[model samples]
Target: MTAELRGTWLYDAHVDLGTPIMVGPTPEGVRAIFPVTGGRLEGPRLKGRFLPHGGDWARIRGDGSIVLDVRALVEADDGALIHLTYGGRLVIPAEIQARVLDLANPDPLAGDRYYFRTLPLFETASPGHAWLNGICAVGVGRVVTGGVAYRVYAID
Candidate 1:
């Protein structure tokens, strides 16, 4: 027997960031830092803007897959603060990876040549949004023009 997975749409996150700071090849992978400037989140359950000074620490592994470690904050309409943290992986074929690295192209990842997914955790102290603290969430992400977009869902 198999169990079906169900989830509710929690939020859509649009994150803005500066150019990645490439750290060159490391023992583990090619490291880079993407500075998160600011952005917004909109959905039925929560709506807010991302706090500044947060960013994603990404690593392009030896196999060309990208690993992401991100941290940020969301302030709901009611002023409740939710701390967001997630780790994700971006898997792409070698041929696609080569195209994505092309500097001449406007949008290297303009097509469906990759898969990006994440597991997100939320933390909050406000009573109104305290339910987030105990929920398990996941997200599907894509590389957008300026940054990245994620459709987050709460597992039910």
Candidate 2:
């Protein structure tokens, strides 16, 4: 048996990251934390801004791919608060990473140049946007001028 995969646009979010706090080589790999300074969100199902209380705890693997461990809170335009967490992989060459991760660099790169994808999950107590609780989602990310923007889609 086979099941086809389908999806619907959920929201678009632009995440701003603060300076990274590098935790140098740990057993887990080269660790670092990119604070979630600010963000904005908008879409058909929901409209909101991401609270600046979370961050991305990324690790550089031996293969050079970075594991993205992100945590964030979303405040829907109506004031409903939702927790958004996602785990993913980002594969970028060291040279590019050095340039892009620098706060000094403001040039946006084309996402097709590297691999960046995320599996997002949402949780909330608000009745109006409760549909996000169980819906599996995927976010395709792009490197913006100073941050990363994602177009999230709900699996249907």
Candidate 3:
């Protein structure tokens, strides 16, 4: 038997981050830390905002791709707190990276020049949204002016 992959649009997360703190190049890659300031989360089933103090520990690989390890908290409108963790990769072409670096103001509209995606796992103690713990989720992201935006989907 074969299985078909299906997904449900879960939410759009607008996450703000502080400037990346460069950790310099390591044997694995060039490491950096991006502090999560705060942001909003909106969708049909889940609606809320991200709590501050979370962050992404990123590594720029030898080939210029980015590996992202992120952790955050989301507080639902009803006061339920959810733990969010995701790992993703950002593949940036050299030409596009050069263009972005050369520009005084990088255009977020040029997001098509690169690919950013993540596999997110959620954990919650709230009974109302407990179903989330059992399902797998994925998200597509883009770098915006002040932060990153992600459209998350639930694998069904």
Candidate 4:
């Protein structure tokens, strides 16, 4: 049998970021640490703002792609604190990889220009929001002016 993705557009999390702390070259690749400043999370199932205490420690690959390792805390509107961590890949076109990492570019490329996909796993102790723990989500992300925004969906 073949598989299909009948997804429910669940929520969106617009994560803001501060300057990246460059870790220079490593055996694996170039490392950059991006701090989460503040952000807005809005959607039908999950709604809240991101707490300013998480970051992305991403390694830039040789082929213009990014291997993402991110962890963050989100506070739901109802006061529930959720912990989220995700590792994914972002494929950048070779033609624009340099400009994409140049921080000073001041412009975000259109979302359609690259492939930014993520699988996010969430955890929370709040009974009301425990459904997050049982769902597998697919996140389609884009680079925004000040941050990255993810439109998450649950596969049905």
Best by TM-score: 2
Pairs that clash in candidate 1: none
- Please list the residue runs of candidate 2 whose C-alpha ends up more than 4 Å from where it truly belongs after superposition: none
Worst 10 residues of 2 by lDDT: 99-108
Q: 1 or 2: which has the higher lDDT?
A: 2
TM agreement with the true structure for every prediction: 0.88, 0.95, 0.92, 0.92
Candidate 2: what lDDT?
0.88
lDDT of 4: 0.88
| Candidate 2: Cα lDDT at 86 | 96
Candidate 4 lDDT over 12-131, as tens digits, reads 889988899999889999899999998988998889999999999999987658999999999999999999888888888989766665544578787888899988889999999999
Report residue 126 deviation for candidate 2 (angstroms): 0.3
lDDT of 1 at 24: 89
- Point out where model 4 deviates above 4 Å: 102-106
In model 1, state the lDDT of residue 120.
Answer: 94
Encode model 2's per-residue lDDT on 1-156: one tens digit a residue: 889999999889898888889998988899999888888988998999878899999998888889999999988999999999999988887778766556547776678778899999999999999999989999999878657899999999
Per-model root-mean-square deviation over C-alphas: 2.4, 1.2, 2.0, 1.6
Q: At residue 48, give the lDDT of candidate 1.
A: 91
- With candidate 4 superimposed using the best TM-score fit, by how many Å does residue 125's alpha carbon deviate from the native? 0.4
User: Which digits, one per residue and each the tens of the lDDT, describe model 3 over residues 1-156?
Assistant: 888988999999999887778899999999988888899999999999999868999999998998999999999999999999999998878867655423234466566668989999999999999998999999998887667889999999
Q: What is the C-alpha lDDT of each candidate?
A: 0.84, 0.88, 0.87, 0.88
lDDT of candidate 3 vs native? 0.87
